[model samples]
Target chain A: MLKNLLMALFVVMQGAAFAEIAVIVHPSQGAAISQDDISRVFMGRSGDIAGETFIPVNLADSHPAKAHFDQAVLGRSSSQIKAYWSRLVFTGKGTPPKEVGSDSEVLTLVAKNPNIIGYVPLSMVDDSVRVVATF
Target chain B: MQCTKFVWVPALFVASTVSAVDFQYGGFLTVGAGTIIDKKESAYDYEGFNCPCFISDFNTAGLYERGDIGWKQDTRLGLQGTVRFQPGLSLTAQGVARGSDSSVNLEWLYLSYDLTNEITLQVGRKRIPLYYYSDFQDVGLAYIWARPTQALYGWEASNYNGASVRYATFSGHWEIQASAFAGNETVRKSGFARIYDEVNQDIRWRNILGADLEVTRDWFTARVVYLQSDNSITDKPDSADFSRPADKQRVFGLALNADFNDWLILSEFNTNTRKSRDEELSIPAPAMSVGVGRRIGAWTPFINYARFWEKSKDADYENERFIDLSATLRYDITSSSAFKFQINRFSDRSEFQFVGATTLLSANYNLVF
Candidate 1:
């Protein structure tokens, strides 16, 4: 029984380490997004895409997908991003992206708002939302 | 006096009426103590303080007087509240209390309306964009320095009743922001007494028209600003006192900053002139500062050099000039909190002994909550 429990724990840890994150948008949006575009959107540097208004969504810091997405796509650590936003927030220059708690919640938000772009675990993707990019 | 008591009534009313919207309350605090290590007397005593003293602002005057460690100079608390009525509209109010002022003061009360994704219009009182850090100078957690170099940040009035229109746009790997503002202010008792023989006088800046532009491409940023105003002064117009004739004021400023994740560089230069027929009454002040820092994990160590000079050649005017060399270390206790220790070496180079050479040591714990 103990051996079985150890094997189960190892498998869970391995799965978490190899989890994939996907950047998603509403199905109606068809614009292509590059890594630089993703970075700009998440960093509050971009206000729109092709003259269409859009907003970025973020996962809570405690979520494992958040760390993976920030490192793989945004090219910054969680702390670095926080510090960057601190400068903007205090200066009244910009506000960080709105945050949600779970992948399912992110899927719901993205599916409902064509103007929002978000990230979730690749396994959470469905027909309701379109995958813009994945990492 | 009665008018001052009603300043927050409108804000309170609006906040109360918006029960469904999100209301955010945030604040920042800095408790700092420093001492001037000077042993000799100098002409800085004109402001009733010893040489080597640092003045952060006109009201928060007299810091680190010779041989004294006190928290009354740079310590301050600021509170800000925001009520968002919807996606593109909001009201923000900010108040600050400094150890120097002993009373709470409203620093910002503005309504912001987003006309488009890239344009915003703000109406109400705001900080004058005289320098790069003028907008968030009170938030210590936002910058690495123990304080923005006082030599350059010092000004007679920092706030004005104004309206500003701002435009921001981002291109591939580049971002630009531009602003145009107009405003006026009347300080009943001028807080800047050091330049006027330590006598409190009423001061006014009328028809203030200014523009600021900033551009950033990746790690580098540059800014330029220009402003012009008409100035007037009186000892106390309503109390039967002397008055100084109005004059013309013009200012120009520039700043460049670079951040390479772990390495940082900050620089700014500014020149301002008040012109009048009376040479003694005319003032020309120019200042500059440069800083470099590197981050090692959660710790950042930095050094800065700043200089300010009075360029007016009037024989009747008291000449003032000083240079400051500072070394600072910052430790981030958390994402929103930091501890800083700094040492400053100040030197006087004026024809008149308005300031004397001295050393200062200071420390502060700053946090935003």
Candidate 2:
């Protein structure tokens, strides 16, 4: 019985370590997006894709999906990204992405606006918004 | 403090009466203290200040004398309000209280219009971007330095009544932003009191026009600017004047920056020339600064070197030169706040030294809300 309990704990740990994140866009967004494209969009470096402007939505600061997305795709820590956006905001150079509280809120908003893009845990992906890439 | 109260009273009154959705507010603060550790007196004493003073600008900010840890030199607070009554149009006003100035000042009050997704126009008072850090100098959380290299970033008049057109665009991996501005400014009480013999002077810049271009690609960025103005100086109590001509002043500046995630590099060079037929008045002033930093987790440590040379063509005028070396450490307390400590060494290289060689120790806590 003890051996069976240890086996269950190892499986849970492995699942947590390898959790998947999905980059989502409006259902009408049909163009392919690479990881670089997603990074640029979230960093305020690019505003358009396929000759149309798009708004990048973000999860709240403490979200687990945000931590995973920032490290795995954006190649930056949360603190570094926050500081980067702070410089731009105070200089009137750019505004940061609008933040929602949870995965479902992001999905709901992206579903309504063709110009909005967002990210969530892969398990939360549904038919309302299209998943462009997954990591 | 009275000035601050006077300005905030009306601002707060307006905010309370207005619809909350139309108005948004933000602010920033920096509390700093510093002291000089020099043992030698200055060779040439400035009007009221004793040496070995840490002269950030000859007479403006960072004026540290011996034996006193003073907070009044760099501490400051700023409040900003934006009113958005319509889409693509907004009005923004910013008020700042400086410890050195001992009064509240209107730093930016402008109406901005978004012509399109990528173009903007602004009119009213705004910061004159003479250096890379000039526009956001008051927002300490935006920069890594405890203070920007003063030798290259100093200016008597930092704002103007102006109109500007800005365009931003991206092509593949390259991003470009360019702007053209025209404006004029008048400073009634000169900030450069030491150079003006302790008398109140009126400095004016007329027919001011300038253009700035910035380009960025990945980790590298570069900026270049040019400005021209008709400069004049007159005594305030009495109308004694300095000789002036149209297009009497011209300035050129360049900056290059690189940020490779963990590594950062910044450099800027500028030259200002007074155009006069008389060789005595046709002097050129040049300044340069270079800095590098490394980020390790939440802390960044940096070093900077800066120099300024005031070379006069006339035989009777003495050239003044100074160099500064600084080491700074910035630790982020949170995403919007930071604590910084810096040590600076200033060396006077001119024959007649106004501020002798000195060392300064300074620290600051900065926050944005």
- In model 1 chain B, which range of ten residues has the least summed lDDT? B1-10
Q: Judge the docking of candidate 2 as incorrect, acceptable, medium or high.
A: acceptable
Q: Chain A TM-scores, one per candidate?
A: 0.88, 0.88
lDDT of 1: 0.79
lDDT per residue (tens digit) for residues B186-210 in model 1 = 7766666544446667677888899
Task: Mark the regions of model 1 whose C-alpha exceeds 4 Å error after superposition.
Answer: A1-21, A27-30, A50-52, A61-72, A75-80, A102-104, A120-131, B1-22, B39-44, B194-197, B236-242, B279-282
C-alpha RMSD between model 2 and the true structure = 6.1
Runs with alpha carbons beyond 4 Å of true place in candidate 2 = A1-20, B1-22, B57-62, B194-196, B236-247, B276-280
By TM-score, who's the top model here? Answer: 2
Query: A128, model 2: CA deviation in Å?
Result: 2.9
Worst 10 residues of 2 chain B by lDDT: B1-10
How does each model score on lDDT? 0.79, 0.79
Q: How far is candidate 1 from the true structure (C-alpha RMSD, Å)?
A: 6.4
**lDDT by residue (tens digit), candidate 2, B1-369:** 001222222332242346323455677899999988776766656666777888654335448888778898778998887776665678888898888886799989999889997899999998887788888888888888888877877666778898998999988788899998899988766676445357767677877899999999878999999988887777555665644553378899999999887999989999988766544467688989999999898899999999989887777777778899999999988766899999999887865646778899999999887
